[model samples]
Target: MFIFFGLFADPVSDVLLRISEAWPDLKVVRLEHPISAIAARFGENHYDLSRDKIPTDILLMTERLSSETPSARFLLLRTECFGGICDNRGRILLDGRTLFEAEGDGALRRLIKFWGADIGPEEIFEPLGRSFRWG
Candidate 1:
């Protein structure tokens, strides 16, 4: 299965890579925020992040997309929540809930299982605890 972990410029990629390694079969796509930002900075390219955007008051092309493919997985592995990354386009893809708030292991595993998929051991650590383990 394909799992997307949207991340901004941060140490999130480090953690996500570790998790993806544990699950060899799962396809994990790491989308960088700078790439999206570049797309935003240069609009003609049509760098649609996920073909999902929701209109909001602050921006024109602003849009929101949910996990329509319950089976197709995605996770927000960034430092900030949904509102922090809301851009002029307003097309942010992710729920407002924090990764910790998503209940870590249980919620994540369930989401995978529900889709008849398997999950790797990608532990979500807080910013302060980021250096505990770098394996």
Candidate 2:
């Protein structure tokens, strides 16, 4: 029940499409708005923040994927790899340290791979190979 919001629609939709095609039983829900927005708009205290968290509590946000400036970071996740930075070439950094970098759609793929590790993509379908993953 990993809820996603911070990331853009490009990669998330791509993975969802593939997931739907392979595992029909796998449940993947895309909310029209973030939980915070929903709670604020509807005036309903549905989500209990103290007792329960938003699923896996993972949020990956990309500031500027393609840029030459040092200020252009690749990702900003909520947990695990939160605050991960990227160089002008999209190299990942954790806690001002280096983890790995991706070429072309590698950033998205690596995130997907991280997602798979948690959700067990291997148990459901064939490995999500890296190829034209970005659109």
Candidate 3:
């Protein structure tokens, strides 16, 4: 399960789209403001966000998600900038542990590839000719 906070920049958004395409069953939730509009799911667990209040602290948010989806793995991505280093920098957390402190889109792509390797398809074959092979 992947939970995203804030608006995703173009590069990050593209990577996310690729990931979803590669792993069709992966659950992804983008949490946006007003807080009430976001609906999230992880594996068999589903959440209704209409009445829920989101925590401002990252740790607390992590805890909340962990509790909601106990057995599922989680990746939290957010766009955050500090100390005037706001060059599309983002933070990534894997299972409540900081995977990348402050990194750009390239780092995110690598992280996704690494974590998604086993779960996603080993090979993606594009169409070669008029006849396409399924499987």
Question: Highest lDDT, which number?
Answer: 3
- The reply for model 2, stretches above 4 Å from the true place, is 1-89, 105-107, 115-135
What is candidate 2's lDDT per residue for 35-133, written digit by digit as tens? Answer: 110000100132243332222222121212212123222232221122332211123433333345443323444543433332232222111112212
TM-score of each: 0.21, 0.21, 0.31
Q: Report the C-alpha lDDT of model 1 over 1-135, residue by residue, as the tens digit.
A: 121223221223243443343333333333332121101111212234453332122122111111221221233321222532211111123332122224333444433332244444442322213232212
lDDT of each: 0.27, 0.27, 0.33
Instruction: Enumerate residue pairs that collide in model 3.
Output: none
Stretch of 10 with least lDDT, candidate 2? 35-44
lDDT of 3 by residue, 1-135 (tens): 222233111223234454344334554444332121112222222232331222345345554443443333334433223443322233434444444543464444443343343212222211111142212
Candidate 3 local accuracy as lDDT? Answer: 0.33
User: Candidate 2: lDDT of 1?
Assistant: 22
